[model samples]
Target: MAKHCTIIQGGMGVGVSNWKLAQTVSKAGQLGVVSGTALDQILARRLQDGDQGGHMRRALEAFPFPVMAERILKTYFVSGGKPAGTPYKTIPLLAKDNPRELAELCIASNFAEVFLAREGHCNAVGINYLEKIQAALLPCIYGAMLAGVEYILMGAGIPLKIPGVLDLFAEHRRAEYGMHVVGALEGDNTTMHFNPADFTECKLGSLTRPKFLAIVSSNTLATTMVKKASGRVDGLIIEMRTAGGHNAPPRGKLQLTDAGEPIYGERDDIDIAKLRELGIPFWLAGGYGHPEKLREALSLGATGVQVGTAFEFASESGLREDYKRDLLQKVISGTAHVFTDPLASPTGFPFKVAQLEGTYSEPELYAARPRICNLGFLREAYRTSEGDIGYRCPAEPTTVYASKGGNAEDVVGRKCICNGLLANVGFPQVLNGQRVELGIVTAGDDLVSIAQFLPPGQSYYSALDVIAALEKGCSVLST
Candidate 1:
């Protein structure tokens, strides 16, 4: 017999669903997930920031590969911290043929995040990744597996090949993921490969193949994943239009409401009964932050619920204090509004945004920031005229994005989500006149629902509070 839960703390990326938050939930006997997206860069930045609270140092010490840990520490660790106003050094952008250092960083960084989250907890922990961020997949998965991560939850794109990659690493073999290069002809080489032998000096350690859960929005994609995936997909997470982070685009031609939000109609509704016919475990997301919702999911035959907005504002989460405070106040007042912005993300998926002042979601704030593309995480790789590959992001400068085939109109109100997201977790970069560029914050449509997690008269709630609220009624499903 094995343990399962009726609630999963959804993986919020760019350090929002951090180790401490995840650990808190997992310790309370529910599935806790650490966001594995952009962790390599986040880890490097943390090291440069003097390894705050010595937590990174502890995780690095626990890393199985001592030499790899040593190499990363020697390269990125600053004794005190980088001076104020001096930007953290950016690592080279990940390409099909990555530099060895970048590859190592990906592995070590992913390992550290999961390792820290699982520390002192025998309960299972999970890692989440967006399939669109393909560059770091192999090493990132490898590192999480190395850290004994119990589950891997992925969404934002159909990940047809990830299960095979997990199997390869579990067997201590090399894993190769095909990169989706824009404008590449049928015969063009676009596969990225990672061999543990190349990086590990000794024989590779045996790794466990974690449970694979594909996040999906509809029954059609769920069926496709079950029937067409390269390997075993353990489960599915059914995220509705209301979930936080990126969302699946509406089917057919995109239509907008008078308020500018993407219109989700009858076709967008998921057929849960059809989902059950697939014979796989599934969790319901989006507005599923309440205990009543958990019961509804169970009654409907779901294994559990995956929640984001509530846990996101918990005290232990990595969201910055000012933003969290403002948002929490709104939640308490039942006035927080989340709009499904269709143009904010480079991936072109409908991104959920909290309407906060001074954030990139605000028109004035967005207009004030100059267009730049330093992060490049969201840059798309395309085959150049000479058969070389080039990367570009629609959120970059208008002239540059246009030259790369992006339509100026399509990018009109688009904000650079990469930098903004990084800023959300307190690493906002300072530009001219000490103006900190703000990243738009994304949360589930149940923004006001977070208030339920807080006790009456309590101004703040802990991750435990969220878990308790979610687990109140069903004892058997609590763990």
Candidate 2:
């Protein structure tokens, strides 16, 4: 039997949970997960920044396909990084019918990250992906598998087909994911296909199928996944509304609080009793970062808990030093606050925004920024009048979004999450060589409590510090 991991480090924003953080947590004997979101773009930007520390180049040298690895290095790696104020070159946005170059980038980039994270440790590592980003899903999974990823966790949608894709990919066979296209007629083709053989230079043995853990918010979703998922669902992470990043919208009619946040009622709560009846290992998320909460989870039949906010500010995470410094200061002063903004995400899901000045969370800063959708990670696919799939984002220019059949109201209050998240990790794109993108910070409600991990007289904490604290919590209660 596989040993249970008592704690799973949360895979956070953009590059925030990059290889370094994940590797640190995994080295501490817990399951560490790297954020699989926008990894291709992150890898490209890292190379363009001169592959600092020679880490990207090191990982690429170990990639199975030398030709593919060489192509990526040649295309993106700069001699000493791009000049300050110069815009980072953009990769093509993903689509149902993606070009070969984009697919190769996804595969190679994912491979490099997982490869690097798995280095210097024999412990298992995981990768987290948002199911909504379907276009790049196949190649990304294939790349991670090439680096021997042990777990694949997904949330943000009904991921019924992901398990089956894992099965096919393990045998090095072709895999396809059905793209969800809005306003599609009965016969529209919305399937994305990828084959490992097409991208490989030589024959290879079959790979192991990584265990799949679907992140769910309700008993209904969990039950549906266990009973109807195309293949075996190894486990689940039950995330509450208080968790960081994109939250599952509240159940039933959308009601807002007086403060403009979504009102999550009793119905929004997941029934732990029902989840226990499913006979699978499950973890509790959201506000379970404390020792008492970890103890409570174990007593309630949970396999473990996944923590985000605490690890997010850890010294090894990819979060920018200035932002981390400011947030930690707020945590110390009790001035830290998180707002669950209902209209900020283009996905229309509620996103938690940590109150930080000079970020997009500020009303004045948000309004001053121009609406551009060049990154296009969050664009929704819709059937055009020509019966072809066209992409649109509410965060795009108002007139441009409207011309693509998007509602004017939908565009209201929508912020460009793609750009904001990238900027949070210090890779913001420079538009027209002058307008630099600003970042928006996201953290769970537990952001205020992360001070417990800080050493006496120290402003920052490490992943080992977090693991020791949570493990001590579990140990104290177990004794």
Candidate 3:
């Protein structure tokens, strides 16, 4: 925990920020982050694909718990990958009462990801999780901790209790997180619990409590994190609407622009002055990928910039080669269109989507993909009138969502983000008749500038190129 990293590679979801990207970034003297979101599924899918390059197998072999790793590999590893177009084995959804196998996969998969990322590098590796995915939080954290993950970065929701959970797990104690059931009555139980001892594979000692960085868009939330968090607030990641993935809703009343994106006015600003007054390190996200912008943020008292869009297109990133190639070409031609879709994500947060013709961003493609919720990561839990806890996602079939107490209006324009994200990293699902997964790309407003990383006559770039551009200043780069 010697704080020297000035750049943090954002942990893109559904396997986008895989070990390759994080390891490359960390090797270059920066913080490399692996997305902890749905890593169990990612590992399973990778194992199903024959554990290519033996990277997954290597990590699993090093996993402290050999038996657990063996079980996972035995269940999912395919000899030469399932015959051509067969569908991947389905995984159960995480809930207040999760299946033991699902929990074990969560722990093993997270460990494997972090272990691989930290391989051959002493530089700190971090794991990113959305607090909105509450049910699987405890075990994931413990699993990452098992691999000595240095940082736990969480956002997409207020995560006041996570720091405390980190504290508990590091002490080898049990931790409980109350799942936010939308309509739970007073005194009804909705807690998710995890005890480290139950899952330990060998004799173990207390773990190191990783530094916790809570992503926030406002000074209010930053201050609240330090003042009200369950334990130590290591730092803050101040992101803006222009960043990729889900964005914080505009402050106060929600308003939409003519383009159907959130209308972020003055009130939505993070108030850098107030943030400075908080007396802790904070990284500026959004359009801060350029050298000049990074310099400006440091001048304004930021530790560094949490950059996503730039690193996201790097050769090491998990983004499919074709998707990266197409998007980068559009960037070079100045034809890339990024839409901040308000209804695409089931979590009700505005999701930034890069409009690509061949992907789900296209009208016909979106319309043709049958609505399904097999992943269920963004499913919302609510209390039924009959005193039972129920889960529903707006992205699920309109009829099914409505039957579970979800409103019809909530389902409009909602895409299957879970499936679409997996597709972005080349792990898309395959159904009958050769139907394939489609990509739904998300990027920041800085998508156009990613081309700057390219060397003369080259159409692609690497993670080092991005770090170099930011550190040396873009003005130094020759066209």
Candidate 4:
């Protein structure tokens, strides 16, 4: 049996669960998960910022694909960072068939992240990816495996084929993923392909296939994964709607409470008894950051608990200092509020947003920002009238989305999540050498209680503090 971690740090945002935070937690003897979302952009932006502390460079030096690494460095690594008022260089958006440049960036970036996170530690480190980012999945997973990642966890969509992709990559074989294109004619080709041999400079024999964990919210989905996945699903993470980032919509009809939040009925609740019968290790997420909640999860047959909101505010997280300071202050003042914004995410999934005045959570702030889709991480794939796959994001300009056959109504409250997430990590894109993108912070409903992680006299806390606090309940239960 594979070893299971009692505390799996939830992979929060674009760069929130970065290598620094993951290394800190993993070195402390728990599972530290680096967010696998938008890593290509994260790597490029950090390099443009002078590759601060030479960490990215250090990791790239160890990357087996020297030529690929060199290419990325030459393309994005600015000597002392870009000019004060200049916009960061943007990479091309990924699509059904990505350019070789973008593919190489995706691979090298993911490898660098996992490599650095695993530095100075023999303990297991994991990379978490949103299964919805299908365009980048192939290259990204290949990169993580190259760095010897121990676990791969995915959420935000049903990842039934990911396990099989892992199996193929282990042997350096060709792997293809069927892209979900909306309104594709019967004969349209909607498949994305990646072959390891094509990208490898030299033969690097077989890679160890990492364990796969599918994050799901329903018992039926868990059972389906166990029984029908393309390859072995090592475990599961049952995340409740209260968790941070993009949440699975409530089961049944989309009924909302008076406050406009989705109402989760009995159908949304996980049947722990049925879950136990699946015979796979599982973790419970969403509001499971507290010691008592960890204890409760264990008693109810969970392998452990995955906590995000707590770790998100920890000192090691990659969140920008100003934003972190503002949010932490709110938490301390007992005024931190997280709203489940059903219309914010381009994916149409309900996204949790921390209510901060100056951020995109405010009506005025969100309206003031110009709509752009340069990053394209959250764009949807659709069949164009010309019989080719095209991409569209509702958060883009209203006319742009409508021209691509999208409903203008879908663009009503949609925010540029890709840009907002990048901004959260202090890499907001500047347009026309002016207008800076503002960030939209996402956290679990438990954001109100992160203040508990702060010591009595201190206003800040570390990832270790959060881990130790959650483990306290388990230790006491054992006693």
lDDT of each: 0.87, 0.93, 0.90, 0.92
lDDT of 4 by residue, 328-354 (tens): 999888888999988899999999999
Between candidates 3 and 4, the lDDT winner: 4
For candidate 2, what is the lDDT? 0.93
Weakest 10 consecutive residues, lDDT, candidate 1?
470-479
- Please give, for residues 133-155, the per-residue lDDT of candidate 1 as tens digits: 88988988988988999999999
User: Per-residue lDDT of 1-479 in model 3, one digit per residue for the tens?
Assistant: 44747899999997889988999999999899999999989999999988789888998898898988889888999977877677899999978888889999999889999999999979999999999999888888888999999999999889999999999988889999999998898889988889888878678888888999999988888999989999999899999989988898887788888888889899888889999898889999999999988888888888889999999999999999999999999998999989999889888888999988789888789889888888899999999888878889998889999999899999999999899999899788886648898989999888988899998999889999999889874334322
Ranked by TM-score, the better of candidates 1 and 3 is 3
Cα displacement (angstroms), candidate 2, residue 65, comes to 0.6
lDDT value, residue 161 of candidate 3: 95
Measured by lDDT, the strongest candidate is: 2
The TM-score of predicted model 2 comes to 0.99
Better of 3 and 4 by TM-score: 4
- The stretch of ten residues in a row with the least summed lDDT in candidate 2 is 470-479
Model 4 lDDT at residue 254: 91
Model 2 lDDT per residue over 197-223, tens place: 899998889898999999999999999
Q: List the candidate 3 regions with Cα displacement exceeding 4 Å.
A: 473-479
